[model samples]
Target: MSTGPGADSAPAPTTHDSRSTPEKTPPPGTRAKSSMFSSLKVRNYRLFFAGQVVSNIGTWMQRIAQDWLVLSLTGSATAVGVTTALQFLPMLLFGLYGGVLVDRLPKRRTLLVTQTSMAVTGVALALLTLSGHVEVWHVYVAAFAVGLATVVDNPARQSFVSEMVGPDQLQNAVSLNSANFQSARLVGPAVAGLMITGVGTGWAFLFNGLSFVAPIAGLLLMRARELHVVQRAPRGKGQLREGLQYVAGRPDLIWPIVLVGFIGTFGFNFPVYLSAFADDVFHAGAGSYSLFNTLMAVGSLVGALLAARRGTARMRVLIAAAVAFGLVELVAAAAPSLWLFALLMAPIGMFGMTVNVTANTSIQMGTDPAMRGRVMALYMMVFLGGSPVGAPIAGWITDAYGVRAGLAVGGAVSAAAAVTIGLFLARVGGLRLSVGWRHGHPTVRFVPRERREELTAAA
Candidate 1:
């Protein structure tokens, strides 16, 4: 693959050249050097990364401020939950349609519009809050509007990665993106807290509103000719159904998504679990809850970095990560001490992120570029949409039984789903369990059925 900024400008050579230029030639130990940050070598992806760093921090700030503002306004936690629900409601209702639109439109242009809309919502909210005329309804309206924009923005941004860095760097880019988000997550809340107490929420909102300029400018500055543009899907009816059918037909595509659906619905309820564990189980209060979140964020950041370093996404890795994520949660649910439970949050975060990044990269790598938008839309829809349905069940379990039972049930469901899906995938792929010694160590893993006789004879 070409690494230079001008590589896209030249036509490909018909044959291999022994005399490649130094600029295009990779170093002797290129793998070690490039593993963690190979995607940033692309000029376009670098711009996107830089822009997102600024924008994402601002976004996290807004999220903290928004929830806090809603709580203050109504003095009701239920109202705060309602506001959170409104932000995600649009995606649950219309996410697939948004995907169809993304496939039909130019990704960069679509993102510009969506980002602008989100910025407008932020600025409007800031003005209202600053003027002392803000109402709960106005905050609700802004949240919904931002959600509406995200419906289009999420898929567009996801698909656009391929354009910026091409297929070779897709997995690394995606992993880095997660790292970027988690990094912002670590910093944004602290900043928001400072702004809220020292100044007010209005400045945080204003900062978020203006952060859109970074991404918008990045979009404008990107070189159009360098992007690896996919052919846009033509305007047509039944496109949503077509996307669904495409996923349904491919076992490789469908099964991972199904696994994610179950896990996402049941396993990813960290807020409820963490808070309950903090207050009810340990009686450690809000400081402990915040500490738990920070540790998890650190683990998530580590997980993303590891994924990027690995530079490949495999189904087995995804399944193993899913299993580990579940088992870790189960162990943490029964942790005897507050410190032990808090420490376990790190591994839980790491495994959860591994599952996320691995599944995302595998799905994208396997998908047709033309169907990329819709497929990602479905993937995100299942992942994000499941939260609403799952959160209430989790809450009910916590309220009725206890936090431990609620968490244990979720972990059991996730681990069971991973095992079932892993076996099914192995079967479909014509593989069987192989148990033996490899080199010196004992080994047990799935292997191709055709290799069974060869392995037995060798043994």
Candidate 2:
């Protein structure tokens, strides 16, 4: 079903790298301990997770501080969007090639290089801001630099999960990773708000720069022999084209990527929307912005925990979450009061996290290990790279019409895409819509066409 030698189009048998050394099974006695946090039993994964906990908090802090700084300096939402666009533009332009490089390189060493490069950019920005000589352009440059690093870092980190935890725990491990990120999101913004108000954005930037030490140390501490080694793709021409063709032939992989590309490009422009809402619509300033983000983090953390507990990634869940996420954003756009608006951020975040985690895990689980880096790069590219295309447009709409109009437009586009893609997938999968009352409840679902006919005959 795929162009690559052993690419998988389905979930069940696609978890491990067919070309790699035998996967490391969980330690004896731990096999029966399958639970939400089962992946934590792996020593390498545990260290990686702990290091990310610290680093991710710093990441969130930097994000909040950076957006606020840009908004403060320009007083234009468009400029803030431009900053975001610059940061992700490289991903859009060069992500595919980055994936190829990731396939060939040692994931750990590649991450070290990328992480250090990003740290340098953060420190440079911190110095510029602290010295009181920072310009909007300097922030732009730093953001772009980080983007370059992310081109390689994102795909490498994603593919590395299998190496650390193996296929048995991949789903659980991916979910926990999201949970860890959301947990950091909960703390980082609140702290960034205080720092932005009390000290300054520079300190937040500095903190982010220095936070790399933990992850670097963790990487150094990992036992090399324990890793489940997936063979690196040999350098050869048309490898990029090979990865593309592999995905093209897999309906499961291509459809999800297309769905997320639309959502990410249009629906995920929160930096623009939130800042404008806090400043223009609500007049509450940075504190309210941070509060909105924190509440959203609360919902995201809940969603991630639930996903970890579920221990599976289903396409149905992904589609439902995407629809819910879009609808929530539409509701939030018209919120009449600050508190109401803030309260709505939770569901938006929850559904958004659900869509994100489901797509990520499903794609990883379905892909050939040898081709994972490229596939993930395409996934991340569409998911994150769309920001460059979406952010500026969102900002312009906010400036021209209003935050409500801009947000509603984005939500509408997202919802439409979800419904369209859901139906298309259902049809292609040979399922028919089944909507009616079953027992005491209303049921709306898709079933095999033959099942639908059988049900009709029985009725």
Candidate 3:
């Protein structure tokens, strides 16, 4: 679940060329160049990447600052949880309608308004903090306002990728987008910690507010005539229901959404987990907290780059990543020392990101363009909107049982969901998990049911 400080789980670079391209683009299943930065070759996408890099770093800074700010004011982990809940509560309530809005409106125009609103919210918070009038209520209202803006921004940005780079680089562009966020993840937290310690949280918020300028400028500078715009959904009745019905009829779309709901609700409550661990379990200050985030960012950056290099996202990859994410989190939870736990954050971040990039890319590739915004809204809603419900539970667990148990619960649920879905998909898809020796090496593979008889006869 990408949090407010940054749109952490937003789309990364991936390319899927639509048939409407001037040239005949390859089929949806065709592989792309494995270069991690391949999508940047397009001038429009390049501008978007550059602008987003700056904006995302600022976003991360705000996220780190926002969480710390709340913790400092209240001194209760539960209160911190409440702030996270407040930030995402609007997403739970209005995210679907935002999707409907995105589909009906021009994506670029919609993004412009949403980004500007978010910038205003950031500046308002900074002013409040700097003026010494910032209270718990101000923070709450700012969080909610940001959430409300995100309801539209999230889907608009996801569907906007196609317009920038077209379908050919869809997967690569999307993966790069994640890498961009992860890259920001590395820089933002370290800088935020220093700012928080050296100056105050106000400066970080101020920096984030101004950073929105880059994206606004970039959007204005784009050559509108060159954009590979998709067909917009017309004004019509039952649009929201139609979007839901479309997904409901497709197993490929619906299952991933369901899986993300469980994982997002339980596992992606990291801000709550990390903050509590820093403040309570480790007794480490903001600096130590920043270090943990930086290390995880390192892993996430690596994972996103690797995903970009792979050039394809499959259901199998998503399942494997989810399982690994859970196992790594569990291992991290059991680490006895702060340093060991910190080191484990790398793999945990890597696998967590793998699941993230995989699921997002798959959904986009499998979906219809006209319905893209609405479908992505549902995806974002499941992945992020659940934070309102999950954060409080995680906070309560962290406050009561200790950070370890809270983390373990998230890990267990994440792993269980991945395993359950994987096995069920295998059964329905007419595949069996086969274990055997290939030459001298033992191997496990998923074999099609029709191929089992031939393999048995040969053996």
Candidate 4:
């Protein structure tokens, strides 16, 4: 790949160069340094990135405030779970249709509408809280509205990244996006906690409501001249079914989606567990709750940065990370003290990000440009849609078994899922697992030794 002033001006190279090239031309499979932050070189992406950073910080703040508010009002773990479920239920019900809409519409326009809708929802919630008349049912209604917007917003946003950076730098752009989200996660909760303690939760919601202006402004400011536009498919019959078939045919896409569904449904429902840990297990207040999330975000930031440094997405990395994530959660559940539980959060965040970044990068890289929106919609369904099913179950478990046992159940389910899926892939892919460290980096060779011996015996 060549990196130069005209990098975006000139069309992407049609064929790989075979001869030894100059330093400016990176070797095949090796990305240029410029590619690490290449999307920023595009004016549109720069605006989008900046806008999302501000908006995402507020989004995180609102999440913490909302959870805290629910707990304060009801003092029920199951209530918190119900709120979360109400918020995500829309995605579970209508996410596929939302994806089809994204495919049929202009992503920028879709985002503008969704962002505005979300801002309105936030403002309403803040107003209700400020009036001191907020009720649990009011929160429930608002949560559902936010979730409805999310079902549309998520697919539009995921597909929008490819248009911003083009295919050449898609992996880098996606990794950086994850990094931005984690960075916000690190800052948002701590800030929200302080703001809530010093002022009120209403103010946190107000801040979130105002934050949408940045992204809206960024959307308005985008230089449409620079976008690498994908041709929209004509409205046709069975579009949703087509997307499903397309993904079902590819094991690489299918298995990861399955894995994420299991992880999201069984292991990643943090609201229920976090609330229980804060109120019941540690007897800590909101500050400690925010601190726990901040620590997890710190580890997530590290994971995202490491992912950004990589040039390619590999399937084995996804599998290993999923297994590691599950095990870490198990350890966290078993911790004897608050500090130990917080400590385990770091590895949990790290491996969780690894699974997410790897799966996201792979799905984007592998999909056809025309089908990107729909494919990503299906991906979101597996990712976020699972939360509705998982949150209530997690909450009930936390209510029944105590927080520790609830968390342990989630971890055990996630671990079993990873091992089962990983082994199934090995068999289907004809892989044997062997381990060694190459240049100090651990490596697993997937082709089985016995399979190799059998082939040799036949020969």
**Per-residue lDDT of candidate 2, residues 256-333 (tens digit):** 999899889899999889999999999999999979888888899988888887776778889999999899999999
lDDT of 3 by residue, 257-371 (tens): 8888888889988888887778888889887787788889889988988898887777898999999989888988888888998898888888888888888888887777768
> Which candidate do you rate higher for TM-score, 3 or 4?
3
Best by TM-score: 1
Error of 4 at 94 (Å): 0.6
Residue runs of model 2 more than 4 Å from their true location after superposition: 1-34, 64-84, 123-141, 193-203, 279-286, 396-401
- Clash pairs, candidate 1, are none
The clash count of every prediction, one per candidate, is 0, 0, 28, 3
Q: C-alpha displacement of 427 in model 2, angstroms?
A: 1.3
Which is the leading candidate under lDDT? Answer: 1
What clash count does candidate 1 reach?
0
Model 1: residues >4 Å from true position, as ranges? 1-34
lDDT of 4 by residue, 1-459 (tens): 122232123333333211112112224346445345666787888999999999999999999899889999999977887888888889888988888888777777789899999999999999999999999888889899999999889989998888887766666788889989988887898799999999999999999999999999888777665777555555777888887888888786788899999999989988678878988989998777777777888888878777777755777778888888988888889888989988888888888888888888788777765566778888888898777778889988888888888888888888888888888888887777766567989976676668667755766
Clash pairs, model 2 backbone:
none
What local distance difference test score does each model get? 0.87, 0.86, 0.83, 0.81
RMSD of each predicted structure: 6.1, 6.6, 6.3, 6.7
What would the TM-scores of all predictions be?
A: 0.93, 0.84, 0.86, 0.82
Candidate 1 vs candidate 3, TM-score winner:
1
Deviation of model 4 at 332, angstroms: 3.2
